[model samples]
Target: MPRIVLHDYFRSSASYRVRIALNLKGLAYDQHPVSLVAGEQQSPEYKALNPQGFVPMVEIDGERVTQSLAIFDRLDALVEEPPFVPSDPPGRAHVLALALTVACDIHPLNNLRVLRYLKTELGQPQEAVDAWYRHWVVEGLAALEALAAPQAGTFLYGDQLSMADICLVPQLYNGRRFDVPMDAYPTLLRAEAATLALAPVEAAHPDRQETAQ
Candidate 1:
């Protein structure tokens, strides 16, 4: 096996997803902690490695990959067992839709950079920014609930864990941080509970990581 190095921050939801995917794939990797809160991602050192300066950057096979979903897709291709998305077109699209709902729709609007931009750049008070976070989370979760509930069984898609579940857990962690009321999305809550209960998934949790604050 080739050496794998993970460049990440402990609290980054994107980094958290990559950790979960690696644990799920049973791959081992070294970690280099980059503090987003302290603006370490803007340093020249990390910028040389990833011009985008994004967390969850995975280096393996002489290549550095950015973006959590891309890393997950690569890992699934790397290891055949416990596939991330289904083999069939429809199934793959369905699962990817669930994952994208969180990644593209929910996460972008509420990530740390956006929140900081809201506060420092836009001069929005913390109260309004927090409300902005909660509102988007609720909307995304409601959409996920509707889409996932129909196919959900033990996990978000079915009994087997997919990329959707990997993406879902991290978003829920943020929703909890923002104190968004989640009780209404019983289906999502059930899937989240099931996903977090897995030992591998638990091992990748932000609080459990060595670099956690």
Candidate 2:
């Protein structure tokens, strides 16, 4: 396998998702920190890697792949063991749906660029911005809790930790960062505890020093 390099910021939820997937697969990769706070992601060098200037662009076998979900899918295809998506058709669809609920419906509303726009362009107060952040998270989490309640076991998709679990863990981490109350989602909380207890996830957690940047 060629060297894999992850171009990401420590605090980016998207980047966090990819990190979890990589760790779960037990793949060794180099980290190339892209500081979104410092505007490093907008630089020409980084922009060339990903035109959207997003963190979590992965270079695998010298191929630069953008987007967290795509990177995860690609990684899963490359390494078959410890499959991220379920083998069963319906189960795979269900997992993808849950993952998309967060990736598509929730995360976009709270990304750094969107929040910055709310504060700078819209002139929204910090409190208002935080309220907006928590609102969407709570809404999404509520839906997720209902979805996971029946299927959830040790992880999001029952006993096996699938891609949905990888996606859920990061969003849960983001929800906590923004002080979104998670007491309503008991199933999610339990799954999160189980996922985090895994050695790879524990080791791959975002470093406080790196995130503070």
Candidate 3:
């Protein structure tokens, strides 16, 4: 297999999700950090690699994969041992539904580009922008908490950590970043705590600092 190279930013929740997936699968990859805050994602060189100019682009065996969900599916197909999606039909559908609840229904509105546009173009005040962020998070999380019942085991669906857990950890991380109160979702809090206890997941945490050069 050709070396897997991931173009990502440490702070991006999308990139963070992919990183967690890679770590969970025990796949080794090279990291090429793209600083979204510094406008590096919009440069001609990076744009040529990804016209969308988004973080979390993955190059695997010379095939470039864009979109976090697509990249995750590819990784899941490549390594079948630790399955990310459930095998049973109904369970699989439920897991995918929960993952999409976060990836599609919630994440886009809170993306960095959208926030930047809100501040610069719409001239939305910081308080309003933050309110928007919290609103989506709280609404989405309420639905997700309902989906992740106490009947479910340590992880989201059951004892095993599936894609839903992978998606939830980063979104919860972002929610705390934005000061969205999490006390309402005790099940989600427990699931996140259990998922993070795993060695691979803990190693992949975004805040883990790199050594000085």
Candidate 4:
């Protein structure tokens, strides 16, 4: 096994998810923090590694892997101990659908770059930007609530921790950080609490990271 390096930001939801996956798989890796706020991700050197200039880029043995979902998939293939996705096609699709609902629909709309664009380019007020963030989180989480019966199970899909739980935990972290009210989503909140109690997830928390302010 070669050395693995995780290039990520502490508060980044995508990075957080990858951290959980790596820890869950019991993989050892050095964390190289890229300060997204300080604009280090856009630097010439970092951009050379990742053209998209995104956080959560994993460098394994010399090869670079981008995208959170892809990284988790590769990790699953490499280490079969704790599976990342379901084995069956339907089960896999179901888990990925839930994961993508948060990663694609909710996260993109409220990420740092988009929020900055709203504030800097569009000149949106803080109140309006916050509203925008909350609106999307609530919308996406409502659908997730409908999809999951978390009270019956420890995780999003079930007893087994799947990609959906990995994805949902970070989204909940972001939601709470933004002070978005999640009272209406009981299943989501319950699942969030349960998921975070796991040692890997707890270790991967944003506040526990070295870059945390």
Query: TM-score of each candidate?
Result: 0.98, 0.96, 0.95, 0.96
How does residue 137 of candidate 2 score in lDDT?
96
lDDT for model 2: 0.87
Give the winner by lDDT: 1
Cα RMSD of all models vs. native, in order, equals: 0.9, 1.3, 1.8, 1.4
> What's model 1's lDDT at 115?
93
lDDT of each: 0.91, 0.87, 0.88, 0.89
Worst 10 residues of 2 by lDDT: 204-213
Candidate rank order under lDDT = 1, 4, 3, 2
lDDT of 4 by residue, 1-213 (tens): 768999999999999999999999988999999999999999999999999999999999989999999999999988997897778887788888889999998999999999999999999999999999999999999988887763237677676788888899999889988898888888777778887888988999999999899
lDDT by residue (83-155, candidate 1, tens digit) is: 9998889888999999999999999998889999999999999999999999999999999999999888988
| lDDT, residue 172, model 2 | 89
User: Which portions of model 4 miss their true places by more than 4 Å?
Assistant: 150-152
CA error at residue 53 for candidate 1, angstroms: 1.1
Report the candidate with higher lDDT, 1 versus 3.
1
lDDT (10s digit) by residue, model 2, range 1-213 = 768999888888888888888887888999899998899999999888789888888898899999888988899888887898899999999989989988998999999899999999999999999999999999999999998889989888889888788888889889999988889999888888988898887766777325543
The alpha-carbon lDDT assigned to residue 168 of candidate 4 equals 91
Deviating ranges (above 4 Å) for candidate 2: 208-213
